[model samples]
Target: MAKWRGPRAALAVAAGAGVIAGLTLRTAEYPGMLPAGTPDPELGLGLRLVCAAAVLIAATLAYLTFARRQDEPLAMTCLPGLVVTGVVLRHLVVTLPGAARISPAARIVPGAGAWVLLGSGVVMTAAGLAAAFAVRKTA
Candidate 1:
């Protein structure tokens, strides 16, 4: 049988997940004003920019994780995983009920975008951790 893959496959998964996450965010109808004081067109543009930046960052990090060697420190291998986890946790905190108490509009309703983001985050985190484990195993 062919040798099993490692970080490469995980990296691809992460990239795909990031793309989906970005698209979801781009098309999703976020409640309330985005910047609080911006005009509608500017706010829309800003949101698009933010979405693009997020996707770029995620994809870049995934690539970086894949590029690291198996001999690298485990902490280094796990850095991207940690970052991804942080992003997901941040989103959850901002969208959950506690946030609603702070700002009613922030409460996340179950929508395609929200669901996609949640799913993508789960996949990205899992794949990142798996990649780190594979690196450790092969080191």
Candidate 2:
């Protein structure tokens, strides 16, 4: 067994990031932060955190599997970057009041796509955190 110290650290960081991002996303809200009739965004922060963690875990597992095979370095780097970009975007959207001006649901209702974006951001943040931690541990 090729000691899983790297993966373990990655998982831990991913879990932490997920919790943080979920809470952040939930906080930057307007009336529950869901598209109405969407079950009040589930358990809000907790659910988002779990979703983020799962995404990170899945991506980390993929990296481990590919590294074992030794033929997907390109894919690994690109995938992680894409995930980071998404996370960053979500963070900006949530943190910036400017984004709120865009009317997430101008043609629909307020805070419509914001919920979806927040959810996606949660996933990406987890993946980015996992990759970042795994790489740091290895290096």
Candidate 3:
């Protein structure tokens, strides 16, 4: 059996950390960060779905990395990138003129959840890239 070492191990750790961070963001609410009104239901649902997808991807990455499976590192790299894209899209949706007109509360600044998601994505991406590089060097 191949031992977990180097970049593969690091990727697994990073993925696990992302999963934890995403879960924390889901449960915790930041008061006063959002305006004193209900947020756009569709936008909110989209954000939640994106977060859920990220968490799932991270979990899968963690498993594959821990197992030392190197079959699809490149494809794995895209998972974190997708998470980052989702976060960016969420920001755009909140800040767009149409969003502001739909709900004045849309002007509210992003809360801890946004920051956590961004950070998690960054870490996951970095770790995935490092693992991919290691895989290339070995192959």
Candidate 4:
């Protein structure tokens, strides 16, 4: 197995953590009459399910990669996290532009979690690609 396997495994774990953190954190913050700003994930039912499903699949792939020292499973691990990131970004893209037009007091802003989720997805995908292209030496 190539030496990069160890770091790739770590990347899988980090990506899993990123998925959890992203769902737990706010997707967007809106200024309002409430003391604390309104957050998209404050209504957590749908997001909770999405987060759980992605993390579970990613964990399984990570285990398969570690146990077998196989790059294929590691590459597969990238899918779940990336899907979540895509969904989140799509929501933002489809919704955010007209959100602030509702009222002067109603302004939606991207939250820290959005950036973290995006970074995590990018890292996971890059690691997967590297694992896919790694060279195996002939005996």
Give the top-scoring candidate (lDDT): 4
Compared with the true structure, what per-residue lDDT tens digits does model 3 show for residues 72-136?
A: 54337546556764664556454444445655644544445556656666666666666566666
lDDT score for candidate 3 against the true structure: 0.54
Instruction: Work out the TM-score per prediction.
Output: 0.48, 0.31, 0.60, 0.79
Please name the candidate that would achieve the greatest TM-score relative to the true structure.
4
Inter-residue clash pairs, candidate 2: none
Per-residue accuracy of model 2 over 22-72 as CA lDDT, tens digit each: 445433445434344332322345444444555565456556655664222
| Candidates' RMSD to native | 6.1, 9.2, 4.8, 3.8
Off by over 4 Å in 3: 1-16, 19-43, 69-75, 92-107
lDDT of 1 by residue, 41-134 (tens): 2113443354455555556655554465432332232344344444444544443444345445544343454445545545555555565566
Worst 10 residues of 1 by lDDT: 37-46
Cα lDDT listed for each candidate: 0.46, 0.43, 0.54, 0.67
User: Local error of candidate 1 at 89, Å?
Assistant: 4.3
Q: Rank the candidates by lDDT, best first.
A: 4, 3, 1, 2
Candidate 1's displacement at residue 44, Å, is 10
lDDT of 2 at 7: 52
